[model samples]
Target: MTGIEAINVYCGLARLPVPALFAGRGLDPARLDHLMMTERSVGLPCEDPVSNAVNAARPVVDALSPEERDSIELLVTSSESGIDYSKSIASYVHAYLGLGRNCRVMEVKQACYAATGVLQLAAGYLASGVSPGARALVIATDVSMADARAGYAEPATGHGAAALLIGPDARVLELDPGAFGLYSYETLDSARPEPDRDIADVDASLFAYLDCLSRSFADYRSRVADADWHTTFTRLALHTPFAGLVKAGHRKLTRELTGAGPDAVAADFAERVAPSLHYPSRVGNLCSGSVYLALCSLIDHLPPGAPPQRIGLFSYGSGCASEFFSGLVGEGARQALAPARIGERLAARVPIGFDEYTDLLAGNSRCLLPVADRDIDLAPYERFLTADPGRGRLLVHRGTKNYHRTYEWV
Candidate 1:
């Protein structure tokens, strides 16, 4: 019963449509058809990794009973957009969320796969019964550094975080006990050598992702007997760098496992996989949070009294690790998720144009600066903050003073 007690996402306060970005970059318009995305979130100058992480988890924490909040014994922040080499992002997240002093706080980084790894690890801790009734929090937060320089990849990059509250309750998603598979190796498919610089060999990344999917599923099949790819799960949610990638991955998997052709694969995809792409299509890629976003999207489709569903999840990270796992969405998942208002908040996101997007890149690039002192100017983006203030208390980075990052609620 140790699994997701709750889940939520904060996809920032603004978005840039893909078409606007492509036109702004002088890229081929036809590329848009291949991406199958509508827009991407833009991390405001006042929103850094810390702010994004806190904002994402704040609502979930607020909903907890004080006793439930105090029961949170572990907090793990996963991201590649870390601000300091030595200070774990979990430190800031712990302070902002006001967790107890006895709790363990740490961070993990393995590209996009980090969050899923920590989640399983955390779930294992809960299932261990060493700390009875204890809860764990995992926040996968990252800021996008994409600009025109990234070409088409720029429009698909995204910002923000997804939060998971895991415990014995398992109200949202219940992990299938001892049913998982993993695969890992090293490759230069993608790398963020510098804080602001991202390098990716697209062909290599694609190959690695697809390769990991097959290998990991093979490992999964070994552990769980009679785990039919077509029948084991009612729905599928995979790490979505883009909607097109998920569709292609599903095609390959369907053909490999069931010998399905184009028409069958398309029909199966629409039924099992497409539901998961709704949020990812709009928010672009949230790094480690992307797959969870997909999960959220799929669960969002659960009707008022839908039956419990088994879901298959696949996560892949560059430089490179992957996992194939399964979970059951509780019958009340849709009710548990309603407070997040994912779609409503997304609709309220202020849409910025090409020129404003170009202006935003300057701020986006400096998000991970190691400078000892700096002040972020939120004055320029005041409208975004004011547009939907009632959504909830939003967190923003005020500045860094004497190497300490400061934040204020807006």
Candidate 2:
């Protein structure tokens, strides 16, 4: 079965510590302690989803040999942070990465579940025997911002991206063929129909998440009924909106799957599930990328010389689709990941004051322009400000009438 051959992730450079954010908003200090105890760290932000996807995928593509890069037959981008109403974000990413034009490019949006959907689709495409020796690139990139006016969700919101290179030969995790379960239904627990804001029924969203988790997991168990629930998978990764919710989900899963009492469940979770939370605790919610980010965390923090393990993955998106799947942690998986290096990079991020974050939210110094302006020097735009001139990458305006955009590598 086609599975992840290589994986890379990127978090925003700007870090907003939870305590500082609370202090900035004059929130109670007790709440700060609560967040800290739960291991919440900071949030990251990028100029746009395009940049996030590009930076996340660049390293993985660079690691590839020229022949492997040439063999990429599909590019599927998953996100709700889409810039254009019509054009697929995959097209921008395809050009930015200098991938061949002879590839299929499309965007998937089922809220946060889109990434899982596209991953399955990519696996099916590769397994179809339609294109021998071909590969697919699946990218999950999102930047979720909370409205300062709507203050409650700010602490839970975050931004980041993850890219997975899937093919027949996997050095990382090998996906099990016909070993996935999905449950989807229409619901308005969370939504962002408008560009600038998101609306959610918090209680309803939590209920939906747990419900979907239970149902999808049940479907998974039915498929592998003889498998031992308590000892089958060595690690559990769930879509994390916050550390607390994931804890709750773990407890629920333990009860339903293993019939373990509270004490036993807590013990099992501390050993098996907590390791997966290490990265998400620091990066906040990555929307479509959250579950995959958790998977990355699991690989990054694995112990030395540990035997291969089965990792269970649970993904849920609000408005709302869910899935449960498992992947085998093949040998040499740990050698391919550099969790310590990623931690060091995250440590070097510049922390912003509460005022700066609010200012950014307010668009005070944000580099945005009107749609009618025909003559835009894209080089100076803040979105492209971080582009390395030496790297020969530049953003070019394709057309002014519709803000048609593309990138160039000179």
Candidate 3:
């Protein structure tokens, strides 16, 4: 109804290395009996979030031609960690990816809901026709929450990155009408200082937060009950701050909506976790990227012919805002997702020692040393970097991974 064209999801091909939780930290990856795995990972990669983003975007950029790359309208990045107080990460990505000067860029903040917001915004942009190319690239990347030994985000704490190229085309997921709601008046479930945050209690409050959303869901359902609707969704994907949160929220909402007993509801929650289904057990709460990861996991693991597969996307941001939206997994959804390629990447990663993980986390640049360009020669893509400290510039191609970031100094 919005006259919006298309919203294609082009997942960039790249991965962060898993930190040394296996070797240096005296931890065992095998112990993660209920965690999720990416297409691939490297521990050292987690140290620099910027580099992680650049790495993820490289393959996707290479996939496009110079003209297409130059036509990019915007690069919306969602991250709780802003590279600097004032300087936006969009500038860095625009330069690193070799986009034109006309590219409009901005960073989104709202915890894990930021990326989802980008998707929503892109839909609005497509509804308008001012830009030459109706395309928006949304990228989400976060290293492991600095500390690994503690918290629910642990085990989930690993470095990872994912990218989606959104545009108006007939090839991707189409935005359906009447698909969004914002849950307001809810208290912040988790909040931390801007710098040096300690999210020890972030996941601890998930139940409470889900409870808040469930009440809103109930009200919405009551309002919609009068309209006879035959079609229903196949899956419900939440901005998963933690794996257990999915069960808690699903149970609470299902019981209220279906009138099932606690036992029945509990069983339903367990049923959602299929054997082949790999949840985000390792990547922790990647803020805005959580829901996207859930979608990716379901698409990557679900069996073919899984019908009635409507996905419910839940986005919750502390301070606090929550939303519920749905997407239809059309007949061609899996084919467009390129599942085989994503699966291959996840299967090819190398594990690292926790010490090496910490070392990568402690990444930085030498003040005296000049910025050097990295020689990145990957297939179907050319990589280049330029640094201008004189203008406080950081043009980098695999520059340095310091303080858990690999941002190119452009």
lDDT of each: 0.92, 0.75, 0.53
* Highest-scoring model, lDDT: 1
Per-residue lDDT of 317 in model 3: 70
Look at candidate 1 and tell me the lDDT of residue 214. Answer: 88
C-alpha root-mean-square deviation, candidate 2: 3.8
Full ranking by lDDT = 1, 2, 3
Q: What is the TM-score of each candidate against the true structure?
A: 0.99, 0.89, 0.73
310-332: candidate 2 lDDT, tens digit per residue: 99898899999999998898768
- The per-candidate count of clashes, in order, stands at 0, 0, 38
- Where model 2 places Cα greater than 4 Å from the true spot, the runs are 28-46, 364-402, 406-410
Candidate 1 per-residue C-alpha lDDT over 329-350 given as tens digits, one digit per residue, 9 for 90 to 100: 9888998998899998998999
| TM-score (C-alpha, index-matched) for candidate 1 | 0.99
* TM-score top scorer: 1
Error of 2 at 380 (Å): 11
**Which is the winner by lDDT between candidate 1 and candidate 2?**
1
Which clashing pairs does model 1 show?
none
Worst 10 residues of 1 by lDDT: 145-154
CA RMSD, predictions in order: 0.8, 3.8, 7.4
Model 2 residue pairs with clashes: none
TM-score of 3: 0.73
